[model samples]
Target: MIQKYPVGIQDFEKLRSENFLYVDKTEFIYKMADIGGYYFLSRPRRFGKSLFISTLECLFLAKKELFKGLYIEDKWNWEQSNPIIRMSFSNIGHKYLGLKDAIDKRLDEIAEEYNLSLVAPSIDQKFKELIQKLSAKRGKVVVLIDEYDKPIIDYLGENPDKAIENRDIMKVFYSILKDADPHLKLVFITGVSKFSRVSIFSDLNNLDDITIDSRFAGCCGITEEELADNFVEELKTLDKQEIKRWYNGYTWDSSTSVYNPFSLLNFFRKKTFQNYWFETGTPTFLIKLAEKTQLYDFSEVEIGANALAAYDIQKLELIPLMFQTGYLTIKSYSPMSDVYILGYPNNEVKKSYIEVLMAAYSQSDLGYGVVYVDKIRQLLEKGEIERLEGILNTIFKSLPYELWQKENEHFYHAIIHLTFSLLGVYIQSEVQTSDGRMDALIRLKDFVYCIEFKLDESAEKAIQQIKDKGYLVPFSAENKKLVAIGINFSREKKKVEEVKWEVIKA
Candidate 1:
């Protein structure tokens, strides 16, 4: 039978029954058996973390029928099936009049599943009792908690101290698992972001974070190999150019590139590609993240080397934000460093972020997303550079500099690059080439534009710098015209002061 894409469908049983196209990561089940007993994996929202955990639940419950034709069918022993207990906290309350009491209510539901009650006063006691009772009832309990950090993540900055208290409560409850291990077959947990070090997940000391474990990296999301092999028919019906520009690019591992399961499946299902992930609603926490912590330099800010496993999520670090929101992905692994080089995950996540950044920079004028790209493309193909400059000027004029003032000179330039870069436009900040380095490189179709920006410096000086550096030498062999532009910024108005342009014929 033919398979269709499983766009938003994550329920394992539901997908199997409905015949939603399923990529068999079931091989991972056997792969994981050899790894640690307790594991934690963090991925962006809608990246299929829930589905992975659901598959795990099925495996432990010894659902042999489900694995009959999958990758793990021949690899597993179908003789033993353990008792399964699954809990998802993605729907936890974001706003609570009482906070602590709201957490109690949420945990209470998990308690009911085991017919366990907390005769003890605190929520932690309720959680501990629930786990202990479940462990006793079955020969071995397989506990799968999806979005384990959701309780506190929902209240992160709203009432930070309250968030801390909720974390403390979870830490206490999870700590019980160490003793419950005697009766626990396996335990798995997942979330959008990891806990902010200390006092969180304090109980699960044996928790093995496989977020960067190279062996299972392809478990949650779909790799490009899987896409090309599985979705060849679907691609034949779509606009190939539009599809690549929107859904391609997340370089997870150099050897295995991945398409966002969320966006890829949706694009085929609807025969369209819009902001499928954002449709769930922007994580307001992202806005609060920048505002609470003065992280004004996300764009052009370089993180030289880092490990996804060791990256700190505490008190707002760039790596976590980039990872949590789906900007940076695991690119390469170094067993010695135990680290991963994180970079843009896919075209959709990167492109959609401009909409978020615009709102952060200027709450007022972010209304005009540079998405008017096709319109820009239309004009460019029609040779409307003069009109293009006018429109560019108008867009800059509308920018609220005051909104980005905190970022200083760096913000000014980063925002400029970010603005154009977000529109699927190719922008290079401080690029280096054989003909000497350029402050910026803007590519539109076959044409290449070299640009230099100056503040309190003459536009002529900036223009001369471009010429002196021989920035135009490299474009000599191109079929399209090359343009060199010098931009002057006003220390006075704090916006694009003036632009000097020199267009060269091919």
Candidate 2:
């Protein structure tokens, strides 16, 4: 019998009771509970953070029957149950009611559930009162707050003032966790973004942020080992490597990578490779920010450990935002300098993200962008350089006239970069050689194209630059056919004015 995959089911009791197949993550829960403390984990949305929090709630509530054959079954002391104040900011009706009022109402519900009354008026005071009363009545209370940043993240881009207001309210609301530590057994908070400690978590100094901790990297998502172990029958019909290529590259510590559970499960259900997770929500703000910063290429983005540590709303850095929100992930790390190399996690993210960026930059619909990208891919595969150039010119021609500026050179390069990047082809932009830097290099199965882009300059000059810089030197001895192409965008025409290419011979 095939096991039922728990897709979109966040409730642990419902999942287990309904006989849903669970990738056992109880060992991580045991590790955390055995060393009980206030912990905060930041993972991308739809990566099973909510389900993990629900499992934690069940574990703390001493639901031993739910863990009959799981890892934590015999490990946990099921008799020592604690009052669980489980709150998910995503479902708290914060959009209709204000953040503070929504939280206040949730606190009231929790108090009522425990058969306790709270005279505290403020949100923080009410939180503290609930914890103290719960600890006094039952044992110590366990607090599980899921999507803790939703109240703020939802308002971001749409309303900065409201986002800031919600952040401040959360600052005061979460401040109680620190003071009420005596009454709390465990406080586990999960969110998509990690606001700087100076912002939302200023008062909660003791909270251990294990967002990038290697030990718990596999706590939330489905790891390679876990995927193999759980999806035995499911793997029989699936292309394992293709699946990995599409979904399995997200890493926190650059040591243990995991598949985006939302996408992975959806893939099994649909039996097709699609952007299941990315389609759930578009990163409109991120795309706009990338365009503002001209950050189309993410192949070799490097940042210090401090950069990924935290970022406040006032100083919204693009790289950190992309990293935290699941667009970019740690590809490599250098301990000597404590620096991280970030890139797109997988084909799903790279293709989907670039498609969105292409649509936004080109001022066209996503379908048009995708069709152009597909055409470009086909041309490259067939070595149809002339047709490829025509498509490139057409892409630029479609751009709105009003959006062009004198310094719109980067805009042209960005569109081209996003176009090639979307093809899931091996590509490098701004490639540095011994002599000079080359604008772009695309490596296909049968052809290696040395490409350079010039603005208000002759295509011959761009081609000569590639030759002078010895850009093709690296691929000189490769088995594939080599070709050099130069493209020039005219400032007056605001489109590709010249396209030149040469078939390199050894």
Candidate 3:
């Protein structure tokens, strides 16, 4: 019999009662509970953060039947149970009611659920009253807040004033936790972005931020071992490496990479490898920020440990935003300098992101961008060097006239790089040689194309530069045929002006 996979299930009790397949993350929960304290975790959206939050709620509520065979079943004391004030910000109607009013309403609802009356007038006062009352009535309370940054994040790109207003509201609201610490058993907060404590959790200084802790690095995502253990039958017919390429490689620490839980589960359910996670939400703000900064490449991005925690709404940084939001992840880390090397976590992210960038930069729809990439891939695979000029022209022609700027060359090169990079082939841009740099190099099965681009200059000169710089010298000994192509873009015409190529027989 096949197991039921929970594709979008976030309720732990419902999942367990319905007999859905669970990844058994209770061991991490056990460790966290055993060393109890206030904890904050930051993970990308759809990484199972909500489900983990729900699991914690069940554990604290002492739902022992839900944890029958799980790792924490025998370890936890079943006799002890605490009152849980679980609140998820994502569904709290913050947009319609305003942040302060919405929070106040939610607090009132929680108090009513616990059969208590909170006569406090203000939001923070009400929260403090609820905590104190709950602890006084039935021991200490376990506070679980999920998507704590949603209210602020939802308004970031649209309304800065609203975002800041929400931020201030959260600051005062969370400040209640500090004074009510004596009544709190364990406080676990989860969100996508980690605003500095001084901003949101200023008063709650004792909160332990385990966002990058190695011990809980695998807390939210599904590790390779977990995948193998949980989905043994599902892996029988699928290519493991391909699946990993599409959905794996997300890591907080340099080691212990895990698969995107949403993507992995959808892959098993649908039996198709599409952009499962990326399709759910497009990073429109991040894409615009990238375009503003001209940050098309993330291959060599590095930031210090302090930089990861340096998120500010007033002064938004692109790299850290992308890293915290899942566009870029830790590729490597230098302990000596406390710096992290960041890049696209997997093929799904890289391909989908470049497609979005291509569409945005070219002022075309996503369908056209994907079709353009397919056309380019087909032309390159057939070694039809001549036809590539027309497709390249179409790509540039799609760009609006006003979007062109003084940095025409950079714009043109960015489109070209994005085009080839989406092909999922071996491609390198601005490759350095002993003498000069090659514009682009594409390695196909039977042909290695050394490509050079020039603005206003003649294609013959562009082709000659490749030869003069000995750009093909490195690949000369390979078994494939060598081909050099020069493309010249006309700034005046705003399209590809000429294309020239020379085939050197291998």
Which prediction has the highest lDDT against the true structure?
Answer: 3
Q: lDDT of each prediction vs. the true structure?
A: 0.66, 0.85, 0.86
> Tens digits of per-residue lDDT for model 3 on 1-506?
79898999999999999999999999999988876789999999999999999999899889999999999999999899999898899999998998888888988898888899999899988999999999999999999999999988897777878888889889989988887878988999999988545699988889899988999999988999999999888889899988998899999988989999999988888988788899999757888889989978775588998987888888788898898899899999999999999988988898889888888887787857778777876787798888988998887777777778655777877887787667652233335567765767777777788888888998999888888777887888888888889988887887889999998654
For model 3, how big is the CA root-mean-square deviation? 2.6
Decreasing lDDT order of the candidates: 3, 2, 1
lDDT of 3 at 169: 88
lDDT of 2 at 281: 95
Evaluated with TM-score, which candidate comes out highest? 2
TM-score of each: 0.85, 0.93, 0.93
TM-score of 3: 0.93
The residue-by-residue lDDT of candidate 1 on 20-113, one tens digit each, is 7888888887777534278887777888888888888777767777766898887776787766667677655535434456557766776676
How far residue 120's Cα lies from its native spot in candidate 2, in Å, is 1.5
Off by over 4 Å in 3: 405-407, 425-439, 456-478, 503-506
Model 3: ten consecutive residues of lowest lDDT: 423-432
Quote the positional error of residue 85 for candidate 1 in Å.
2.3
Tell how far residue 366 is off in model 1, in angstroms: 4.6
